[model samples]
Target: MAWEIGAVRWKVALALAAVLVAGCHGAAAPHAPASASEWHGNGAMGAADWSKQLDVTITIRDYGYLPRELRLRAGQPYRLTLVNYGSVPHYFVAPEFLASVATRKVEVREQAEIKAPVFTSFELRPRGGSLDVYLVPLRPGTYRAYCHVKDHLAMGVEGRIVVE
Candidate 1:
């Protein structure tokens, strides 16, 4: 009877050891991608094909964005043009939305063509300043877009970006 109890305890110990080993191995392997290529591999564009992409413009006003709510499609490439008509400099801040999309480049009219994996914000120059963002939307969700310069959000300078 004592040997039977010992045998049961040994079995339980082995099972617990097996579970611990499995958990340890799982922790060593990452659940998320380690690099940008791995993260954007599903929807990244390999070549520049602007002809097929749709153009979407978001004009910046004094205390709001035109159209109020911007809509986009997942897996579609877009030329997102940000134009500031306001007298003061305004920032287009959409951290989560920008992170979800795979950015190809950002063009600032003879300033520079920035190639990056993601963009969190852009400060549009005051009065007729513009920039173009070339990107492919990979995730489908609603993200908040706002202007972060001096009580702008409080003054209703906020909108939503809905990707479907």
Candidate 2:
């Protein structure tokens, strides 16, 4: 009877050790890509060929978007690069602005390239992370762009995009 008990204990100890060893080398799950949207563009020009696009860089700091206003023309392809200089995560949210534009793609530095029909907003992880958003304004209008993280908007992390 004592031998049987000892054998069971040894088996249980071996099983536990095996589980621990497996866990130590377990691989983390891969990151899933962002979902694509069905809405393309609203009568906007189709995707621009890479060579002809213009580039604009926007720096994001603690509480503001540098060059608070951007003037862009309708039907012209522009690449807006976002560089975060803040200590916390920040999001660029512009619903109306995004709606009025046709997205080509969004590229996160060393991360992923999100194609057209991109998400309306994107988050930049704290400090120095960058995102490149390629798009073309489809309509003539003044749209608001702001960071939707906590009270960042109220703190003045806002801007305007004027499409002429």
Candidate 3:
């Protein structure tokens, strides 16, 4: 009987861990915000509401991000646009920042949009590729944003995202 109890406890712990890992890695669909009315059933925002979101554009250059510092207010909606103007592909890697936000969707230009619970990185294609990340800051902290494509961070391709 004692061995059976121990085995049950271990199984429960392993199942809990699996659930946590799945949640962190966004294996499940994103949950809606507390204000259900703010989101449509189809997950696409109304066209008229787009103008109400704060627009923040981050330009991706050859080896750096313009406006190295980004300031955002917690609990506010933002249309974060990422535009790559480099000849080569670059990445926007900010694991902590992405995990702390309530992501609405990530719309990749000329492609399908992604609706996930979290995003860790974005690969920006060369020359005029752009993506839009619609999210609301859920945590107030500073996070490091960098590119990890072949020593890109060492080459001064980095920035900071500050959530207030």
Estimate the TM-score of every prediction. Answer: 0.74, 0.69, 0.70
Candidate 1 lDDT tens digits, 1-164: 99999999999999999999999677643333456674464536654355789999999988899868889988788999999999899999988888788788899978899976567899988999999998888789999989999888998777888999
Screening candidate 1 with a backbone cut-off below 3 angstroms (N, C-alpha, C), the clashing residue pairs are none
What are the lDDT scores of the predictions, listed in order?
0.83, 0.77, 0.81
Top TM-score hit: 1
**What are the runs in model 1 whose C-alpha is more than 4 Å off?**
1-33, 47-49
Candidate 2 at 41: error in angstroms? Answer: 3.6
Which stretches of model 3 miss by more than 4 angstroms?
Answer: 1-51
Give the worst 10-residue stretch by lDDT in candidate 2.
29-38
Q: Clashing residue pairs, candidate 3?
A: none
Q: lDDT (0-100) at residue 137 of candidate 2?
A: 78
* lDDT for each residue of candidate 2 in 1-164, tens digit (9 for 90 to 100): 99999999999999999999888557322221223322445444445455778988878887888879988988788899988898898878887787677787788868798865535677887788889988887779998888987899989888888999
Off by over 4 Å in 2: 1-49, 116-118
lDDT by residue for model 3 over 3-105, one digit each (tens)?
A: 9999999999999999999886674435433344334322333332455689999999887998799999877789999998988899999988887777779
Best of the two (1, 2) by TM-score: 1
**Per-model RMSD to reference:** 9.9, 10.2, 7.7
What is the lDDT, from 0 to 100, of the residue 61 in candidate 1?
89
